[model samples]
Target: MSPTVDHYRIVPELTVPGYASDALKAIVGATHAAVQANVDNLGAGTPSRAPRFVKLLRDKQIVDDKNQSIATTNHNETVSALRDIEASMDVNDEGVDSSTYGTYSVAGDAYVDIEKAVNQLQGTINDAENAPGPSVDAAGRQYWPEAVEGPLRTACATTAATVEQRMWDATTDIQRHAEHINNSAPDNPTSSGYGGTTAPLTTPWSGHSYVPPADAGTIDKIKGFAANELGVAETGTNHVNRPYNIDDAWCASFATWVWKQSGINVDWSNKNYVPSVWSDAAGKGWADSDMSSARPGDLVVFGGQHHIGVVVARNGNSITTIEGNSGDAVRQHTYNLAGGNFTGVIHPPAKTPVNA
Candidate 1:
C-alpha cells in the first residue's frame, strides 16, 4: 500500500497587468498563504500537547523559552511586514474624482522590506529544521519518541521548503513589477540580507572580529579572567594548593571564581560540585544545549558531569576551553562538540562591567 501525503496551498506567481498595486495584492495573498502553510506544518491547532516540531525548536534553542514557537514568531513578523506594505499602498477610492484616478503604487522600500522579512523567516525555518534534536541514551529512554517525531520532522521540512519558496517567488514578482513602477527599488536585491559574518578565530590570542572588548560584558570579563589564568599551576601536591582556596577538584571552583570576579553572583556553596552548579544554573534558566551558538564564558559541563570549564572560543565543532586542573595546571584544551561528554552550556547572568 502507498503512504498518505498531505497537500497544501500553492501560491501562484504574480503577474501585474495594470499597476503595481495589482502585484502587491497578489504578494500579500501569497504571504498569508505561506503563513498558513507553516502554521499547519507546525501543528498549531492541535488539541494535545505541543507538537514535536515545536518541542524540537525549543530543545535546539531556536526558540528561547517554552512559551514561544518558531512558526508563530515568524508568522507574526511576516504578517506585520505585510500590514506595513498594505498600509503604504493607495487602495481606497475615498474622494478622488473619476477624471483623475489616484496612482496605484506602493513604496519600493516597502516591497523590499517585505522581501527581507520573508527571506529571514525562510532561513530561520531551515535552521530549525536542520538543527540536531535531543539526545537519547543507550537505555532507550528518548527525549522525544522517534515514532512521533520522525514523521513530523519530514513533513515540516517539505512544507517549509515549499512555503518559503513561494514567499521568495512573491519577492521576485515584486521586483519584476517594480521595474516598471516609478518607485525606487533596489538594483538586483538578492535573497540574502547584508552579508555573512566572518568565521570565528581558532587559535589562542587571536581576537574575534565580531566580539566586543574584554570589559564589554560580564561574559567577556569571565572569559578574560580565565584567559589570564591560562598557565597557573597548583602550588602544592595532591590538589591541595588549588587556586580560589579550593580543596579538591578545582574545575567548578574555577568556574565560580570567574563568574564572581566578572560580577555574576553564584551560590558559593555549589562551587565544588559540577552537577550542583549545573542544576543551579538550570534553575535560573541559564543552561542550554545549543552548543553551535555557545558564547564565550559559558560554563560547559562535561566528562560525565564531573568536569566544568569556561569557553574561551569556539569554531564549528571545535571548542577551546581553559581549565583549572586538566594536568594539575591551568591550561587551554580543545574538545569536539560531537563528543557525547559535552553535557550542557550554562550562560552566566548578563551584566554591564564596571569598566565598560
Candidate 2:
C-alpha cells in the first residue's frame, strides 16, 4: 500500500531547512503513484467502477494541483483527503482497489450494470455541461438558455435522432417478418370468392395517365393508417366493416377507407365494388399499367380489379400491400410485380386543402 502521509506534517518554519521540502516531495510522489495505480486498476476492472472513481476523485478535489504541499493548512487537508479517498477505494498492498470492487453481483447482470453505470455517467456529464456557468450575469439575461444548455442538449438531440432511425429500422424489420409469416399460411379464405364479380371494366390505360403529386404527406398517412390496421380481424362471420357497413367482400371498402381517412375524396357510390374503384381512377386519368411507377398509397388492382389492396412498398419486381377481408383480417402481402394477379395501380386525387 502507498504510505498514508496525512500524519506526516511538514511546516517549513518548524522543520529543518531541507527536511520539510524532501518530506513534502516524498508524499507528493507516493500520492501520485497511488492515484496512477488506482486509475490503472479501474481501467482494467468492470465498466461502472472507473467512471465512479473518476467522478469521486473530482468531487473530493484529490486530483487538484493546488493541494500538493502548499502551506501547512492546505497540505494537511490534502493528505487527509487522500487518506479518505484511498480508504473508499479499498486500496490494498498493490495500491489497487479490492479485487471484487465495482464487480457485478451476478455475471448475468453485467449488461444491466454496465447500462446503469453509463446512464449515471451521462447524467453527471449532462448536469455539469448544462447548468448556468460562471459567465452568466447575475440577472441571467446576458446569454441565451441555449448557450447554457448547448452541450447537454446537443448530446440528447443527437441521441434522439439515432433512436428515431433505429426505431424505423425495427418497424421495417417487424413488417417484413409479419409479411413472411402471413405469406407462409394457407391461402386467404376470402380470396377465392372473387370469381362472381360482374362490374363493367374500364379500358386499361396503355401508358401513364397521371403523375402523382411531388409531396408525400398523403401517401405517408395512407401507409401509416394501413400499417396501424394490421391484424384487425373481422369481428364476426363475413361481418367486416371498413367503414362501409358491409358484411363481406370488403377489400375495396378497406382500400377506400384508407384513402378517405388519408384525406382523399374517393368515390363511395360503389365503395364495396372492386372494379368501381378502378373505373373511377381510369376515368379521372389516375390509372396506370406501369408497375415500375407504382408507389405507396396507390390502390393496387388484382385479377383485373377482381380484388384490391393499398400499396405500402415496392421493390424491383416485388410489391408489398395491406388488404382487408383477407383471411377475415387486415393482412400484409408481397406479390411479384409481373404476377398474373396484378392488373394495375391507381393514384387517387387528393381533396382540396388536403390534410397536412
Candidate with maximal TM-score: 2
- How many steric clashes between backbone atoms does each model show? 0, 0
Best by lDDT: 2
Query: TM-score of each candidate?
Result: 0.38, 0.38
Alpha-carbon RMSD of each model: 25.1, 24.4
Clashing pairs in 2: none
- Candidate 2 ranges with C-alpha deviation above 4 Å: 1-216, 241-245, 350-356
lDDT of each: 0.47, 0.50
For candidate 2, lDDT tens digit of each residue in 1-356?
34442211111111111212232323333333333333333322322222133333345553333222122335566556545654554343243323223332222233233334334435634454345432445775433233333333233223223322333343354346435543453333343343221212123212222233457577777887776666666668757433543775677778888887777866643677665566557656778877777777788877645578888877787767887767767777776665535668887664434332
Clashes of 2: 0
What 10-residue stretch in candidate 2 is worst by lDDT?
7-16
